[model samples]
Target: MQNTPPRSRIEIDRLRKIFLAEGREVVAVDDASFRIDDGEFVALLGPSGCGKSTILNMVATLIAPNGGAIRVDDAPVVPGRPIAQVGYVFQKDTLFPWRTVEGNIGYALELAGVPTGERKTRVAEAIHQAGLDGFDRFYPASLSGGMRQRVSLMRTLIARPEILLMDEPFGALDTHTKLDMHSVLLSLWERERQTVLFVTHDLGEALTLADRIILMSARPGRVKADFKVDFPRPRDAVKLRETPQYAELFSKVWHSLGEEFAKGRSA
Candidate 1:
């Protein structure tokens, strides 16, 4: 039997989020709506604490929206349902201490009922895909921070989820390592073409990897500006950073967000 490919990977319709503060109401996301086609790379750009992760969380089904709805392949995202369609790599690595790299990567598949006999091959492939080929036997405690993150990414990729919800996956790495990871990730994405929703505060990172940039407003985020990245694929991050158009695009988004920041709405 053959499985059918997903039609649309993610659809966020009129998504709204609100939080109760000490004594006031906080709207984390205000009527936000967007769509990501299967195999598309989209970046959700916003300031810190700007509800970027909130939106990502909503899509990941980690948190339910106060208003509106999110669906993956026409199926509504049921709250707390294990999020099988989504492979989330959070800002930090959440690998288990007792698990080896291979074990960590195979965990999700195990939960999904993948036979133990098939786990090793899939885990090995995921390790290679994540550029952690020789580190499979290493414990999480034995690896560097960036390496730990690789393990996390490999774990997520091994599951072959329809959509990847990445919240600042590279935000914690050093500049050089982050650039390297960016290249590695772009290559993987180009090869697999999984629908991806990436949240980031770095304009350069977003521009380097995203097919489309969704510039979001400050806390209680809204889509302030949308830019279509005109750069050709297999983008060279270093070269793209030096291009005048790249600077121009970043400037535009900066100003758009600056307006919101200047108004004291940013967090």
Candidate 2:
């Protein structure tokens, strides 16, 4: 069955979040609501400090919304620890330098008490999927920036989470490395079909990888625009930029995001 049932559903209704900074409550996200279908790649694009990461963290069950509600497959979010069916990929590689690539990828499985025989099988499959087959014994410090991040990704995948929450996972990479990671991410996502919520400030990054882009405004962030990317799959980040349709959508996102950037500056 090429079109299978959605593996999961995410619904956020009137989601709101606030934080205490300097003994004053500051609104981070206000009345935000969106739904992500099973197997969809949605990018959250907003200016820096616009609470994009805040929203991702809330949905990942790392933080609770002050008001409103979030449901993952109809289960209310009760943020205290990481959600069971969700995986997170952070802006930095969270690889344990003391652990080899194989050790890092299989760490979760080990903790879950997966038996040695089955755990080894899972780790081997994940390493191969991430193109780390021959480098399984390499330490993170010996790997390049991109390879380490790849290992980070494999570490998350080894657990087979139903949903993925990525918070600017490629933001710190150099341009060339960032571009390569985009392809790597897309390749894995295409095969895995996990519901994905990716938080990024880079519009080009969103366009290259997301099935849709949800734009957010400045402080007290809210959805400003929701743009569905009509580009077909197997999209090449470098080549997609040269197309006319890509040009049109790029202009629209830039114009809308420009307003929020200006507001952030003035405040």
Candidate 3:
């Protein structure tokens, strides 16, 4: 029997978050709202401390909002109960040091009671897809930063989550490594087109990956601007920067984001 299609649409309405920091009531996000269509790749961009990660956490049902609401597939998000269809890739690779590459990637399948033979087969396929064909037995400590991140990504994707939330997953990699990871990610995303909500501070990375870019303001974050990226698919993350259209959009986004940066510094 064929599987049912995923209803991964995300809707955020007047979302609010407040934190108690150093005996002060700090407002992180204020009346922020946005939507991410099913199977669409959207990037959330903003200055530091602008609640980008906070919003992702709320959508994942990892945290409760101070006010307002977030819905996934028209269902209200309930804290403490993670959505089964959602998968998150945090900033750190958080791989198990004791597990080998294949062991790590197949951990979820193993947890789900998949038989040994089937688990191994699926793990092998994940390893190949991640370009880690020969490093199946290698541990995370023995791998480079990028290679370890690849393992982390495959581990998440192998679970077949319909919605993927990434929080600056490549922020630590060098330029060359980051670009290579972008290529790998685009290739994987094209295959399944899982609904993606990526949080990043890098303008270039946002431009290269997202179908739409959502910019948030400084602290007490709000939706500052929304941009549609019309570049054709199969984008070369490095080469796309050299195009005139890319330059123009970059300038436009920078102008809006730069203002927020200045505001953040002043406040």
Candidate 4:
């Protein structure tokens, strides 16, 4: 008997979506399909309002698509209940103002009815993993923007999901803070080995963090190009940006993206 090959961690097939906008029909994602292997860091890169978030949300099962199918770990998704299989980190910090860092991190476990002892152990590990050990008692307002985002990240990580869906989680931060968070996130990803589907508008961020970059079209987004990073793993953000290969790849991706951007403006 022959053994079957390993299945993909994520499989999206013929995904489609349409929206009714002010008496006009809008097709957001059309026949978009992609697959991700376990432990791969992949970025969905495109312009604003390009339906990347729409795709992410559909994959998360936060919204059901008009057509096609999504599967995670070879199992079909049950709509309205994607939480257990996937961890999502949105662009905005959705921390409860009333909850402290520890409270927020522990909330997921609480809702899931995890035992008190387990919650404590998981929250502590998440805080330490996110580098927020000393600020467990700090409220969101008391922390810096980066710190708050770190807390948000920990909240997601504590849930221990196999897949991570992030939508420009660092876009709101300043350049320096963004760079720091990138390093932190990369380290965490390397350690955790979760299959991450990251959405970002920043070209450098996509290149720096992703094992593969999926470039999408302007408005009704579709995959335009997918490039594998030839650079060695355990990448250094600052140093990688300085390399000749990095410059070449950046220019190629930018030119491919520029055409769609200009076309978007024209339409």
Please tell me which predicted candidate would have the highest TM-score against the true structure. 3
Name model 2 segments beyond 4 Å from true. Answer: 1-8
lDDT of 4 by residue, 136-177 (tens): 999999989999999899889888888999999999999999
* Candidate 2 lDDT, 131-161, residue by residue in tens: 7779999999999999999999888988999
Enumerate clash totals for all models, in the order shown.
Answer: 0, 0, 0, 0
Candidate 1 — which pairs collide? none
lDDT of each: 0.86, 0.91, 0.95, 0.90
Which is superior by lDDT, 1 or 4? 4
3 or 4, greater by lDDT: 3
Question: Candidate 1: which stretches are off by over 4 Å?
Answer: 1-7, 265-267
Best lDDT among the predictions, by candidate number:
3
Q: List where candidate 3 sits over 4 angstroms from the true fold.
A: 1-8
Q: Model 4, which residues run further than 4 Å from truth?
A: 1-6
Q: For every model shown, what is its TM-score relative to the native structure?
A: 0.91, 0.95, 0.96, 0.94
**lDDT tens per residue, model 3, 1-267:** 998875548999999999999999999999999989888999999999999999999998888999999998899999999898899998999999999999999999989899999999989999999899899999999999999999999999999999999999999999999999999999999999999999999999999999999999999999999999999997888889899999999999999999999999999
What RMSD, rounded to one decimal, does every model reach?
3.7, 2.3, 3.2, 1.9
